[model samples]
Target: MTSKITLFQHGTGAMIVPGLFDGTIDIQELLTHGDTGIGSGDGLDGESIINNGTPLLIRGDGSVTIADDHFTVPFVNAHFAAYSTINNIQINDFQSLGNYIFKHHQYQNILFSVKLHGQFEWVKTRSVFKQSKPYPSLVATAKSEKRFESQHLSGTVIAYYYPDAFSKFAVGGFHAHFISDDQSIGGHLMNFSGFNGDLGIQKFKKLDLELPIDNADYLNHDFKNDDIEAAINQAERES
Candidate 1:
């Protein structure tokens, strides 16, 4: 099995600074890299969830739809998932799911991509609106983010776990997105509970970074401030 994860554009920290919503890469090109992944749509319009090589969008109104062919992404992490094993597990909530993965996946230092397939008792998610020119910082956008929740849901959990060393690249801890089996609702997964699913795990041995060269805002922006990191953490965890 191949071991690699391809990242589109800059790290998450850099994105929070300039808040570049207009993506530099097209979805057609992004699909060439992997079959499963998560990202934000053009103008940060919606949550981008790629399953089976198809890009689906979860808009701010909690609406799930297919992305336009020409849509772009500023950031994304994807890979051809070749699972070592698919374990049937009973997870009561987000914390329990983490504990289970940690116990089963002993390699805490490598990158991990997971797919949880099954029924969920309840789930909560959030998605940010598209930002325009003179875009506010990610911290500001996060403050007025939209949130959605559901009960007795069935879907696939598209998630990734990155090591601490790569926290700036993406959230270091577990980050996930969900799209219901019926494709009606889902977003950046926040809290979930009562799930019985097949947990598919992929360990990546290599990482490929694709930086944005054309975006002048991203290229010349400063990402040295300490508050940026805190904002990212707060936005992801608390929003």
Candidate 2:
């Protein structure tokens, strides 16, 4: 019998609203949950992409390198299933990609993962600089994010979709990160064009969410008063 596919997520987008940027889970511990995933380093240092169990860190300046196992993350989404390629699609940009997925997959109420590999005419991405003590809200941190764009780039795009109902716990809609084949450019994907690539989709049957029970900031934050949806939209979706 085949094991059920599970999406292992550590921490939630809501934590960002309270400016909880400290690491709650270690990188080594996170890797035990899944092999392929996307996340950001402690204190929002950079974007991370775990390809085939190797975690690559993409810093604010768009530099990519292997992340140390001792490193930790404030947020992550990972899974162990090997992506099953569905088709070779012509992706004009991020919007078109979403439209295609919505029209074809139609799994609006469930969590799913997407992986795209091939050449892109151009790709635009952004990463946040590492924050220090007294971290600011995600909205504030995003204001200083470094943006990078490259032409004729070859790489992999890793993304996850959370239904609107899950917005309180995750960044609803599509949250994607990219890493170049050369491991030189990567970040939170902002925009892209001329994407001729193979698309792979994985639908998950379960979502295993791990909360930071011992984190005082997370436990004491006044989440009820904040408009989390708007904050997430501004920090994550609006580019």
Candidate 3:
């Protein structure tokens, strides 16, 4: 994978301890080193920019607008990971299906590390937006959809906090691998996939992980249940 991705996975607190392919083995040179072009002058990842009072606004095209209050930060210094789950991913304001499957979602115990490499933002209002200072910027997205021996690309997806919004870092270029046991690269290519999450205030504890969602005990607003057999059946059906 590229530095943009490593940076994002880390910024959003994606699972996997820094250089461990799956939190079990050590991968050398943890991150894709060299001018990642992402830094806040103070040395912090995307989170730090927000922590330092940077305001980010989301546009319809998936790009971000750093509020004025935020310093002119190219990127961040400290690198850290976020801890989150699909339970938090939402869409269209209604989250029945999403809430059920992701709440306390399943977890894969493979830790990994992240490091951002070359990064450059471009301003291009001529074609898309109206264009302005620094023009609308575009990050050079990377690709890494090759499947692996353990095709199980599972783990807790980390996220971040915006003053008025709750979201994960988006660059039109975030990726992870899902290699099959036989190590075949059959995943999507240059897949423009982003975590489908929602913005909400913490209700239960700091984290509301749904280890299992039982539909039988489900309430009007709670589908907190698990049906492994049904899930398998559904997967089979879809296949």
RMSD values for the candidates in order, in angstroms, are 2.1, 1.7, 19.7
Better lDDT candidate (1, 2): 2
The prediction achieving the highest lDDT against the true structure is 2
Ranking by lDDT: 2, 1, 3
Clashes of each: 0, 0, 44
- How far off is model 2, as Cα RMSD? 1.7
Candidate 3: which stretches are off by over 4 Å? 1-55, 67-108, 119-220, 224-239
lDDT per residue (tens digit) for residues 112-188 in model 3: 22211111111111001122222211210111111112222222111221211111221211121111112122121
lDDT of 1 by residue, 120-213 (tens): 9998999888888888877777777798888997998888887778776577788788998998778889988999878888877677777777
Per-residue lDDT tens digits for candidate 2, residues 40-132, read: 889999999898888989998888889998999998998885677866678999899889888997789999999999999999899999999
TM-score, one value per model:
0.92, 0.96, 0.19
The superposed Cα distance between candidate 2 and the true structure at residue 200, in angstroms, equals 0.3
Q: Candidate 1 regions off by >4 Å?
A: 1-11
Q: Give, for candidate 1, the lowest lDDT window spanning 10 residues.
A: 1-10
| Whole-model lDDT per candidate | 0.77, 0.88, 0.21
